[model samples]
Target chain A: MRTFSRNNLSFIILMLLPALLLVTIFVYYPSIATLISSFTNENLRIPSSGKFVWFLNYTQLLMKPEFWQVTGRSLLIVACTLPLEILIGFLIALLLNENFPGRGIVRALVILPWILPPVVNGFLWNWLLNGEFGALNGLMYQFGLIDKYVFWLQHPSAQIFWTVIVQTWTRFAFPMIILLAGLQSIPQELHEAAAIDGANRIQQLFKVTIPLLTPSLAVAIMVEFISAFQIFDIVWTLTAGGNVGQVINPYTKTLMVFNYQMVFRDMKIGMGSALSYLIMMMSMIVGVFILRNLYNRGVDK
Target chain B: MKTIMKKSVRYLLLYTGAFVALIWALAPIYWIIVSSISTRTELLSKPYKHWIPTHPTLQNFIDVFTTGQKYRAGGTLPTSELLISGLRNSMVISVSVAVLVTIVALLAGYVFARMKFQLKDPVFFYIMLLMPLPIWVSLVSLYFMMTRLGLTDSNLGLILILGTMALPLAVLLMATFIRDLPYEIEEAAFIDGASRWQTLWLVIFPLVLPGASSAFLVSFLNTWNAYMIPMIFSNTEKSQTITVVLSLFIGQYEVAWEQMAAATVFVMIPPILLALFFQRYLVRGLSMGAVKG
Candidate 1:
């Protein structure tokens, strides 16, 4: 190994400074600032009152029924979509992993939703759910499934349903790609060996394939969970603060929407920062747990 | 005969699954395209045939590009100048961020991968922790900071904000690619008495050019599509992005669906083209991040 001289050490430090400075300024500094501000009365309007209040924001936020309800909706959305994404993503991955004509086209199409600008995805769904000109309602009417336009976004449950549908549409491709790569990485001989031992396809999938794909599954789960938790764009454009903001419908409000409403709409910068820290902690805890298992599985090895 | 029957059944299931996946992915996109081409009357008609519009026309496209007239079911409405500036702003910000990220990530990634230094492991861990850390946590603080610095509503500010947003992942991605470079090449360069900087520039950087380009494309797509930051900071037409402008097209009284779809088509073109062009790199990049994690 070449010995590292003082000059070389300085050179490495110099090269690393830009990234370090940027991250420190933007990522670390802001993150620490959020933690610090969460404890204070750092209102955007009342900068003079930005005093350290010592857990007051946290306590107050926890006590807000409105906040809890939004949190519940966020969880509900994630719970509904996580399993569906995993199962759907796995099935698609299995399909794409197979050898067939037009497989490339199919793969590209599958990832298209993931690749498109998410704001556009939200808008596309908005148009599709429009009561007057929505393709969905029109299709239903043409098929004699409904007698009239449903005004899907007006109803709370329907809003949640449509939001989750659009979320699934856009996000499932990520897990699919990850899981498909995982499936491809698995050695073919393991399946052959299972086959030689009189295992059926389903049995082989359960015994060999799933166990081997666990790491990928963990990754998919982590990505899906974090994304679903932070889902804003789809809900924002689809319902705009949800049915609650529109018609006092309560079910469609999520933490992300709730935060936006609080910070920008409500102008409660201190409380919003507190909520942001809360969200960050929740995601970090779950992320740490999943990543620990992923590393423990020795998957990266 | 039994095995043959089972094989055929399996193939049938596979094809059916593939078909469903394709339709599920493409249906919304197809609907928007159809909506963009069809007139408002056609779209609102009872039991509208959405698969293929009865009167397919390019008028919506023409309106979006030339006249800024939003074709609505009610009438032709004037499109805001925000749409034009939004596209221009998005292009400038995305390109600048991509270029900035590419250069910064390359240099930092090289140092992290090749250098031996104190506190390297901890710094690296902190950087990696940022990969999944949500940006909303910092948004409130960042907004206040930007406002104080007089950086709000400016292209430079947005670029800085967006570039930093993308930096963590970019660094990790570049480091992975650089770390994978053959050790012997660098060793040979060192043995030939090339300095460390000389070796990186002459030997390592050239080898990792593909990785640099991947970083560039990824950063471009991300910053280009970013919604919340631009929505928060760039409230004016001068700096609003395509995503923000498109969201505004959905007005309170009536939504101009056809024109929104037309604008949607325009907004998607850059990322789609980039993705198609860099298809292989994208796949490899995604898989590398996944597997390495």
Candidate 2:
């Protein structure tokens, strides 16, 4: 490494200026402001100046039934979707790791849902779930699976279930691709070793493949859960109500949606900021835990 | 003969699994394309529902582009000027944000990869911390800040907002890419007395162009697909993006499934094309952050 000379210092300062300035002006400043404002009583609709009311917003959130419901719904979606996504992702990764005809095209096609804009993905699924003239209904009716069209988005529980499906559809490719990379990196000699020891395919998979895949799998799960927790656009386009829309059904909304509702519908900026902080707090706890785990693993190595 | 039969059966099962996977991935897309091409009559008819449109038309695409027409359910096509302006706004913001983010992130990433500087680890740590904070957390204060600065409903505001969101990942990815480059090349440039700035632009930049371009592409797609920033930052046609408009279509009095599908295809084409072309860089860059961090 180059020593810290005057010229080197100046160059570093000059090069880092644009990024640092932007991050500060836009990200750091706003985040700090949100943190500070979260403590006060601020309302967007009424013009009264906010006065300091420490912990009130957080306490109110704790007291609110809707808040608990939204938090629970967020966890439920993650719990339901993450495992299926990981399992399917692992299966697809295993499949793709093998040599097959047109495998390249299949790999590209699998990523299509992930690449498409969330709003577009949401709308595509919304159309598929439409009660009046949905493709799912058409196919189901053709196959004699259902006698009538299903209103998939009208009810709260129904909305929650379909939203999880749409999210899983669009997002599973992330884990699949990452895990595929992980699988490919495992040395072929290990499989040879297992075969020499009379270990069959299933045994090799359980003993060799999975243990080797733990690191990437952990990374994939952490990344997936984090992104899923903050999901907004897909849910927004899929089931959020119209402007001046009524209170969101308790079953269907996530923390981000509740955050939006408080800010826009309830016009409670302080509570909204508080909710944002809570979301950040949850993300930070998980993020820090993952980082610590990675750090410990690195140290062990 | 028995071995041959077993092999054939295995191939059949493999192909069957592949076929199921393909259908799972492509069915929704095919349905959208089918909807985009079908007319109101075919879209509603039960017999036409299960099969491809016998009479396909590009009227929806043409309408979306030329007349700003959006399909409405059980109603005549409505000319949506918002669609046109939103496309324009989205393109402008996405392109500008991409360029700006690439330049900024490359600079910072280059320094971090190569330089020995004070507070380096701390600065990088700060940026990494910013990564996990969701956009909604920042939206409240960003709205306040942008409105206070009178940058609301403007292209520049949207660019700043989205650019900030894209910076951390781009920088991290770029830094990793640059770090992997051959160090001797930069050393040779330095020995020739190219100076630091000249070395970065002339020597290092071209070597990392592929990495930088991928960074630009990812940043562009992220900004293009962003909904919350544009939804809150820009209220009018002058600044609203494709995503905001597409979402509003859902809440419209008459939802035009065909036109919505058409507009969706239009909005998705650029990113899809970019993703296809830059698949190599994207796969590497995306997984790098996950595995490395």
Candidate 3:
């Protein structure tokens, strides 16, 4: 043990240094810095009196209608997009899981959209959603479904609806890939045994597949929710902050957008810091809820 | 008899589904390719443009590249010189961030994975805990830090943020890969009078490079496609990202449909190609990470 320690101790420390530096500076420091700034009115571009305001920023933010509106909009989009992605992803996963020719090629094709830079996906959909000279509009007019172009982003409902569609496309590949793994992991013998006991395919799916795949589904959803909350790039690119920095879907703003406007647009750095903390607070709330529920589950078990 | 036919036909249905899925996914991309060929005059002539153009031309690509006209937020377009320099800036930021993160993550991740320490487990958990927070939560505060360091619009400023964000997951993944490697090789080197640094350099890093390479790929992808940090830091041509520049084509009065589509496809390659090449290990790593959790 002493020999091992003497031989590798510094090398071990050297390996730890990069991660430690990265975490301390970028992750831990910025988060704590945000926590500190949440209380002050400094918005300090240069060094000034870092005088404390003691939750005044938080109070002012809570009073703003725009803040509440953006929060509501984020929740509404999450509610709409999350379940549909899970359902569609599950179906796609099952379809891909079946033994067939060119299965590897098919899986590769399915993963394509997910790997697209959020910018590419957003731009891809922007053309498809265009009112004039867009492929979708041209097709719709050809089929006599409409006499003229449908202004997609102008209307609140179409923008939000289409945002859901775009978000779904960008994100669905993740859950499908994860779900495919989960489906492949299930024992084939269980299905074979169930078939002999007079169980049908649908019954076997519900009885065996769904329950067993819950953990993977949970991971996929976790990624989706966290990413969905950060759904800035697609929305920003597709809608260009959508008419005074509001979401095209549901006619609201998000914490990220709100903060962007506050700091970069309005140059109100104090309020921007406040908005950042609010977002952090909401994430903590979700994290704590998940943890408490997990604990309760453990106790119950 | 019905059961036998149904069973036989199921395989046929799977192939059909596979074909349809590929077509649906490829359709939009194909439309972009076809539209990018048309003259602006031909594109504007009729309400219903041909799926394949009549006077197929590269005029729009020229206009987008040379004319400097981009869609403004309120719909009327603006003449801006943002395209060429923006592309240069993005390339610089993405490639630099990728190289830097790979080296740092390689060193740190090797340590976390192989070396024993008192705080190692908790420190690793801390990295995971920080992963799920939407990074925008820290954007405002970090902006201040960048400003304090005089890095606000610099490529270095953006690279620092990008490299930092990529570290946590890269290290976590590195740790897992390192832990899986056998210890006997390193132990043998120790007995042969090799110094600790010598053992790490000569023995460990080479054996585990593929996993580090995977982490590098993931890190590079994150930075290459990133828009928000660049969006906030610099909108000027010198430091703007490809994603931010593409959005300039989206305006209130009009959408530069063809140009945006063309630009989007151009910027999509680095990350998508990375995934395509490294897919075998990436998919396996993703699965193992999920199961481990």
lDDT measured at residue B86 in model 1 versus the true structure, 0 to 100: 86
Model 3: residues >4 Å from true position, as ranges? A6-9, A43-51, A240-252, A285-301, B1-4, B41-46, B54-63, B66-81, B252-256, B282-288, B291-293
Q: Mark the regions of model 2 whose C-alpha exceeds 4 Å error after superposition.
A: A1-7, A243-250, A290-301, B1-10, B47-50, B68-80, B291-293
What TM-score does candidate 2 get on C-alpha atoms? 0.94
**C-alpha root-mean-square deviation, candidate 2:** 3.2
Per-residue lDDT tens digits for candidate 2, residues A1-301, read: 4522323777788888999999899988888898888999999787984878999999999899888888989999999889988888888888889877888888887788888888788888888888889898889888888888877788878888888888889889899987998999999999999999999999999999999999789888888888789888888777765332444555567888788878877788888999998888888878875555433221111
Q: Which docking band does candidate 3 fall into?
A: acceptable
- Name the lDDT value of residue B130 in candidate 2: 61
lDDT of 1 by residue, B1-293 (tens): 99999889978888898888888988888888887898877766766555788789988887777776553322443465667888899999999999999899888887777677777766666666666787778787888888899889999999998998888668877887777777788888887788877987899888998988878888898888898889889766678898877776665324556776788888888877776678667665554457553
**Can you write out model 2's per-residue Cα lDDT over B30-100, one digit (the tens) per residue?**
89888889887888776227468888999978876677544343145444677787889999999999999
DockQ of each: 0.50, 0.50, 0.43
lDDT of each: 0.79, 0.80, 0.70
Query: What's each prediction's TM-score?
Result: 0.92, 0.94, 0.88
lDDT of 3 by residue, B77-165 (tens): 34335666667877888788768877776676666655666665565656555566667567767777777898887888888888888
lDDT of 3 at B169: 63
